[model samples]
Target: MKSHRNLVVAATAAALAAGLLVGTAGTGNASSDRVDSAPSSIKTVSSGWSIPWGLSWLPDGSALITERDSFKVFKLTQSGTKTQVGTVPNVVTTSGEGGLLGIAVSPNWNTDHYVYLMHTASEGNRIARMTFDGSSLSGYTTLVSGIKKNKYHNGGRLKFGPDGYLYATAGDAQTSDLAQDKNALNGKILRMTTDGKPAPGNPFGTLVYSYGHRNPQGLTWDSAGRLWEAELGNSTYDELNLIEPGKNYGWPTCEGSCSTSGMTNPKRQWSTGEASPSGVTYADGALYMAALKGERLWRIPVDGTSAGTPKAYYVSEYGRQRTVETVPGKNTLWLSTTNADNNGGEPDGADKVFQVELK
Candidate 1:
């Protein structure tokens, strides 16, 4: 049976009574965290939706959220209102982990009118640009191409870093060796210009910023502007790596952390059953990770380059958490689920997005 969602427990949630209460999303129970964490008050902001893969907030505080299989982009306002802005065209799914995957509003969206999307097309996975005049999508242009894609590992998360460059996670595409290949694009953290060219001062003088990754789907920066990544491992462990330029993460050779000579190890690691991590965001001196197979949200404390022990929340309470991003200028997080993932068996519109307040 499905438990009820959207009951607010504190006065903090009442501040959202303006428009966040307009839709079916409701403020839920105010419960203490499992352990040494803050009181987390959660409420559903949007429901009856599909797999909302990529979430990027705009300058106006509204957000553009992408659906994985639908190839549609929806505009979500602060008042909990959802609208279909436009559909990203020419998107094809691999029936596993491909489609209109990641979306990022250009840092200068107001001036450039450009919205970037990383999707699977007929050829392979590509990063493309489309003109979104705040209403519809037009003028499709391919920015970066030649990244391989497969049924399982597409590594499709995009974020504009503090340095103003676009960073993307490219999976190994079921081919492990390609991760260690310096010339190939797959299984690497790519830093590129807004124009889709290799960013200036790259380690390999190419788009590849770091290599030897498996299927990294999450990217975020701390207050210090240091990059941290979440990677899904093969059979043993999932990794939360402190990403560095031109470093090896040891994918096929090391699942989580190993004694490899030149390979960098994850700051913290988890068994696969404990954390099949996807999207992660930073807030309140911690990294919030959304787990798909593990079905939980992990809050890991960060002290510079070191990661403290992880504390979990909503374990098995939600089906599958997919994307977690910080609400800009707020002490809250927006968490999206992926219950409609993988197989064609699960019906669409079974997913929901929640507003988690770290009180």
Candidate 2:
């Protein structure tokens, strides 16, 4: 049987809704000589998810969450109620990191009511669309496929940009040479319309926007419409990059920042252990990154294309943060923990969703 645990007791949900679980200390590392601002509150919205990989807010203020291992999708209410909507069909869950991963609500959801999903299948990783009826999902339509997949390194993060185009991240799937191949769809950030066709104004005639990425999982656009990405490095360093159209981010040739010609360097880089950053969100003039291996949340201020020193927060308090999204029309964020994954080594009921007030 599929393990679905909803452990939100009435008392716990009431306490969290009343803001009784707020924290006011900077338990993690602060930036160089700069004091960290305390978050107004941090409360557990719900718990007992199994490796929740994707989170997307609906127009009605409810949220949709995807479980990576279970191939299940859930609808979470603000008052701490979780209902299993349905599971995506034909998802091939692998050992390391492959399954139903990222989800993005359609930009015209009020009319179209379509939701997009990225998942690992029998042939490779693919993107598909489904009709969401506000309670359950139906009508799975494969939009794009055949990117390549492996036990690890299937970059699966999807988002609808402000321009109403869908942007997706694709890893090299252990094929390092593919990052340098412009013709290959692997190791690229692809931009497409809702119908999965290449978006107009693309630098290439194809769907490839920026190429030469190893395993980029986080993507967000800044106030200036500049795209930012968080990438996992091989063994040396992880990177926070500013993406440009038709640009190439050096992968096999350069792990982090390099002096190689015709390759774009990262805006900031950190050692592998310190920052295996995943889903990122841009809000209130900063980019918030969820760290998996570092077990913390990083706040990096952005001024145009430049980035300042990064500060850590809630380190080890929430084991292995996976997704961080800024709540619409509010100064709060929705954060999801990934402690149920193998890398976290935590028991069942370790995964949770949190509501955090930004300072």
Candidate 3:
């Protein structure tokens, strides 16, 4: 089994170098212009980079962006100055979507100064924590390992929930059955302590928070503390689900809306051709979703318990939007591009990090 997995990873890396595939990567400013009402007012803050991925704010008023292909993390200042922080640990870069992926800061960052990451480690994709000692990384620990691995479906989104616990999304690794297995860690939203242990009051005794997810690339919380996830469907019916503790998302069994007796239904579903939702962020009392295949930014208005209709901007505008993150203390969002994926468009510089102003 180890040998087979190694061969698969090797092939994936080779394909990546050959430019046969691209990975997820985006961000920008918060604007007063209603993005849904005036789509044309969406402005770019910055751009020009190799593929970029997850994003997070730093203590020095800067931001960190992940470049999956190069296995590097960049610190970007307010003026758009970019500096290489350091390469993430134990990432075996591969094609069609595998590399150093999601990144997040400790919720209590002032005391811990730890940065958490979800990457494709040797034993498979895993979640780990590392403390940033101002200049470099130290005190590394593997919080969780032994996740399923494959070319695609390696879900790696991470965020700190309002409840002071860490929430992460994991793909099924192309093994559809794993999504429904309560004991398995794949295809689920996992909640853990800052030390990587399962938090108390978890629906399951283990790390499983919610199950039956297809490929959840994004997770965010509304002002009401409601959890929302952006998931990628197999061939159709992408979803925005109201995530509940221990609830099933009806993955391989159900695509768009929920029909299963025990699973939760999606609040909104879009065709694959419209939105391959990746990163999700809530700012100014709204949720912003970054699209890859749909090549647009979706501004979905949210009330306490319900979400309004999705208002899309930039349909085929920037090519392939990957991640959307809110830069705190500012009214802007950072958006990235993924034009190197198996389905991404050609052109050497198509992969870039961009800033979009929100209204």
Candidate 4:
């Protein structure tokens, strides 16, 4: 049976009417030198969708997102309208936890208009690239194939790092033991070229950048070019790890704490009850994590490569937060929801996109 542990107990009609809600996380001491500013404002953009996953902003201030179970990619404009851009192919939609997942534009997208996607395919899970004209997609190409898939452990987050290469997250397909196998792509962070070949200068000499991940779903970099990932643990801990090439992260072996030697420890971790960190991003010297099971937005300050205490926002605020992306010009965070899941509360058209302003 799938875990149904993170649902909210009650709901407010006003909060639902306003199209907003919140999640919660534990607090800790400040490890980073800089402190996070208080949250200034939180505003909802839209809701009434199924499981909304990946998010990417367009140049025109519009945004594109994948509706997992629906197998469609939506374009959301500044004025708060949603239009179906294209149907994502090969998505094997599963209730609550799986379907069309992550989306990202080409690093050179202005010229190529290429967008990439990670989804659970008919055979299993796969990554593909597609091109989008102003109105719709023109072509599609598979980038990676033959990945195993299951309902709950599909780690399908994709991002292009500052270096212009794509980094992908893969889950162990519920086989926890696969996380420790360096030769396998499952349960690992992979660095690859746009064509899906192992990236140059990778420490492992294989597609694996780091191994021993449970279900990594978040990837982002700071202004200083450090890579961070958010991972979901089985039933114990959820983690935020600072990634290093070729290092092991002790999944299935260690859930929280730096318990294993020769493995990189998480900069921060929370119990499964506290956080099921999904998507993460760095902006204004802090890392923002979107929690699914935990249902809150967490801001962790970063000093160099280390993390500080985390501040929670929207705890029981919304229902279940899915992804958080940073908006460049405004210096605010854009948060999206995951209300269609079984454990999620008030399942009627409640998923939303929210803008959080840092004071």
Residue 11, candidate 2: alpha-carbon lDDT: 42
What is the lDDT of every predicted structure here?
0.84, 0.84, 0.78, 0.81
Show the lowest summed lDDT stretch of 10 residues, model 1.
Answer: 21-30
Model 4, position 335, has a per-residue lDDT of 92
The digit string of per-residue lDDT tens for model 1 on 200-254 reads 9899999999999999999999999999999999988888888999999998888
In the range 1-359, model 3's lDDT, one tens digit per residue, is 11233444555456535644322111112233233432335544456666777787777777777877777888887777777878887888657688988998876777888999888977898888888765666666899997888899998998988899999889999999999999999999999998889999999899999999989999998778899999999886888888888898898889887557887778777788668889998887778888887777888766665666566665554667888887777677777777665566444445766666655
Q: Taking the tens digit of each residue's C-alpha lDDT, what string does model 4 give over 1-359?
A: 12332244334334434534322222233455465564689898876777789998777778889988888898988667988889987778655467899998887878989999999888888889999886887677999987778878889899999998999999988999899988788899989999989999898788889999999999999889999999998887788888989889988888766546777778788777667889999888888998887777888887777777666667666768889998868778889988767777546456888888888
Candidate 1 Cα misplacement greater than 4 A, ranges: 1-39, 343-345
C-alpha TM-score for every candidate: 0.89, 0.89, 0.86, 0.90
Residue-by-residue lDDT tens digits, candidate 2, 1-359: 11211232344345445654222221122233242343568999998888999988899888889999899999998888999998999799768889999999997889999999999999999999999988889999999998899988899999999899999999999999998898888999999999999999989888899999999999998778889999888888888888888999999888887888988888878777767889999887778888888666877777666776666667566778899998878778899988877888877677989999877
The TM-score between candidate 2 and the true structure equals: 0.89
How close to the true structure is residue 36 of candidate 4, measured as C-alpha lDDT?
54
Worst 10 residues of 4 by lDDT: 21-30
Better of 2 and 3 by lDDT: 2
